[model samples]
Target: MSNKLFCEGRWTEAIAQYQKLLEIQLGDADIYYNLSYCYRQLNLLDEYFQALQQAIKLYPQEGKLHFSLIIDLRRNGRIQEAILNAENAAKCLPNDYTFKILKYLTVPSIYENQEEINFYRQRFIQGLQNLIQQTYLKTKEEQQSALAGIGRLTNFYLSYQAQNDIDLQRQYAKLVHEIMAANYPQWVVSLSMPKLQPNQKIRIGYASHYLHSYSGTLWLTGWLRYCDRQNFEIYCYYTGNEPDPVTQQFQNYSDIFHHIPYNLSAVCEQIIADKLHILVFPEIGMDAQTMQMAGLRLAPLQCVAWGHPVTTGLPTIDYFLSSELMEAENAQEHYSEKLIRLPNIGVSYPKPYIPPVVKTRSDFGLEDDAVIYLCCQAPSKYLPQYDFIFAEIACRLPEAKFVFLRGTLLEPRLKRAFAAVGLNSEDYCVLLNIPERLDYLMINLLSDVYLDTFTWSGGNTTLEAIACNLPIVTCPGEFMRGRHSDSFLKMLGVTDTIAENETEYIEIAVKLGLDLAWRRTIAERMSQNHDRLFDDKACVEGLESFYKEVCSKHFSA
Candidate 1:
């Protein structure tokens, strides 16, 4: 009864049934697991943890109980406990298929910290080497199993190296493609969605995991608010566990708002049942839940936007929301999705909190005479080319220091990349435990110039830097990450700072460092031009007009 109730989406009743079962049998592990599932469904964090702990304690030898606990711990950002539980679970069911899956899920956290990443990378490499040695001694079936395990381990290690090493990403992508073709061929083709009527009101669906506090959601909120109500209906599909105050505000703008937790198939079916004409995937590869949803064709027109600038490489994704500034002459040829350009500076919305001015360099731990060069790019954006460029700038400016905000997963690799480029540890700093987004913005104000990363540009970071009256020097590259800074700089009327190549990039950095007057002039203008770059009203008008044009074409066809 509890399982049936849970499947039927009656989670509260499911919890009641589980509670009754637990009362009759105090040591029922399955009942405790069901209760934990129900609590997780209702976003009752404490109850979920308590129930999961009870389930694990009752069924200490069960792999599934430990797996569930590991998942919950990781989701709640309890990394240390998750790692320990994963290790224990691996020991409990050494040869089980579920154990392999649980181990895969837990391995990423081993690379969450700097020291852990290096340690795991070496451990994985050594394990693969040992497996190769054992293959010669084993039977054919055993050898094949060992090779498969090694393949999976290689993919995990490659994903960790992808940020700082492009060669590794390419090599891993090839290996994964080969392995999938040989092992799981069914995952290749794109899933098709329901057909749509031309005259019907276009039902646009927005999908995201961070529909709560993320900056990408801020842009999406404005787009939904300004949608043409007469011609279109907006549907929001959120995969997040908890809904914040902003998420509640976003709910008010949607025709239908549904939180389908962890059920990708049901979420896709729900959107298809509603006859959604357009499905917008705001986050591409960031969240597993969001990525799984994008793999299914939930609507007739599946689109991706600002959240992830990379090509999703999924055939189900039909279009990429882009702009002239970001999508260069050859972008359409490179990316898998059809390009749809927005009229203005791509997709951006105004942030609710504005940062206050910092009085001095002492505020953020910097010398008054130091020329602070800030790169607030997320750790994944720190490519080899970016390291080379920054090294050149540091070499040219002896008094300059580089500062970065470390991501939860990539801090160690980031520090290593900086060191590899001849930058001293003292010349770099990483700020931790920042309580709010506004605090991050205030720190940007203390910098002299904000340098944009290559390959992948800073999106929200660039906008926030401008908002804090910091001048940004960007050299636009090929894809989404490369072009974001270009679009924002153009929108803010500060295109002179954009460079073309290595020489120009270094020159631009030096100029920004040496010419204080020019830097101040650009910063002052950028501060005044925030209205044009982040105005919600203008963004809405442009989006609504584009929607009308697309609707007209669809109807006429």
Candidate 2:
């Protein structure tokens, strides 16, 4: 009965059946394993862990069970335990490439400090090397599994790299695309496009898994809302499961909105049926189905923008639409697609609706006089090497407090990162609860200075800071992802806070934190220049111009 229920995909019913079977025969490892699978499917994480633990205990040498437990542990935020189990799983299943790859995926979430990050990063590279070496021996089925795993999340690989190497990033992205292409070769071949009818509104489709209040939503909403409805008919193909007010708002602005079903083949067929002249995937690498579709000729012209800000590495993608200010002169060479540099800072953002600050500094237990430097980027954005900057800032300003928002799961790693530079987490940094959007904005408004992450810089947060008229001190790196704040600051005509080097980054952060007059003047200037950055209509106009150029080229071809 349990097996039947599991086979039918009724995971909740399967769990109940498994529990009944378990009550009858308590020591069955297979039952526990099946129970764990059911628990995992239902996302009852604690139950999943317990069942997996029991399964692992009963079947000590079972490599697959250990693998399942590793995932569960990580998912449940048992970071240290997850790492230990991953290592154990690798030892138990020395030849299994999945276990080895899983180790690299889990390691970055919980680094101790610079040394550990460096050590694991090297191990990850070595693991990739090993994965490539063993690929030749695998069966056709196993090879497909390995290829499917490769592009599951390329963001992990991009983030794991010690430094920003655009070449290597391109390589990683290209490899993933190749794997995906190999699996779906039909998608790689260009479809025959019909000539566009004169005077017909060009249908522009935006594809993404995040159509809610996510970064992709935030990045594209302004353009969607303000796009020239007369010339361009906008269609939003949202693939996310969660639908919120933001999703509804996007639907309201769009000529047509589709909640794309999960079936990949069906999704492709639906998109093709729409006969879209152009399709723009705001984010690709993050979603498997979206990335797969992106590898296809769903439209005459398919382009990608900087929702996640990494290369698609797919041949089918025509242009990588980017901001003129954000990208360097040689940025075109880094992308797989033809680079389209839009005038201004690229997309115009909607003006932020600043909610009343319902809560005070005392509510968050922040000291009244402390110079709070908020480093609120996700824990993954934090490279261990950047910990020194925080330490230096704390040292220079004794009354300083660094607030690292979220990543309670990454506490062990974060503590170690800070501890490496002789700064304790308690003394230097405060971990705050991930507040609601309005509260987060309020926190940004209240904070003294925003310290932008080096590698994967803040995108939406940078815009939010600018909206709140808060001062941000940024250190732009080699990649486009690191240059968001730099672009925004430059666009806002405020360059004093743009740090050229790590030394400058530290100097600027300290200067802003200490000098009240200088900081106030910059903040005031930011408020004055907010209109320059929040030109949503201008962004739409620029985007429409680009679209016209691309569509014209497509039609002429």
lDDT of each: 0.66, 0.76
lDDT of 2 by residue, 1-557 (tens): 88999989999998888887778876567778888888877768888888887787778777668867876576555667887887777777665646656765455454446787677666656665664455543356655665555524344434534364445445445555555566666666666565667877989999888888787557588888778877988988887688988899889989989897566666777778888888999876777667767766788889998886777767778888888888987887667788888777678677777876687787788988999998788766777667678777877898898887875655665566668767776777788986577678878878999989886788888888888778999978787887888998988899999988999999999999889999999999999988888854666677899898877876777
Q: 282-348 in candidate 1: lDDT tens per residue?
A: 8665665565456555665678886766656666677778776677776676556677777676665
Candidate 2, which segments miss by more than 4 Å at Cα?
1-51, 56-68, 72-107, 110-157, 160-185, 407-424
Query: In model 1, which runs have C-alpha deviations exceeding 4 angstroms?
Result: 1-200, 358-360, 407-423, 427-433, 536-557
Evaluate residue 441 in candidate 1 and report its C-alpha lDDT on the 0 to 100 scale.
67
- Best lDDT goes to which candidate? 2
Clashing pairs in 2: none
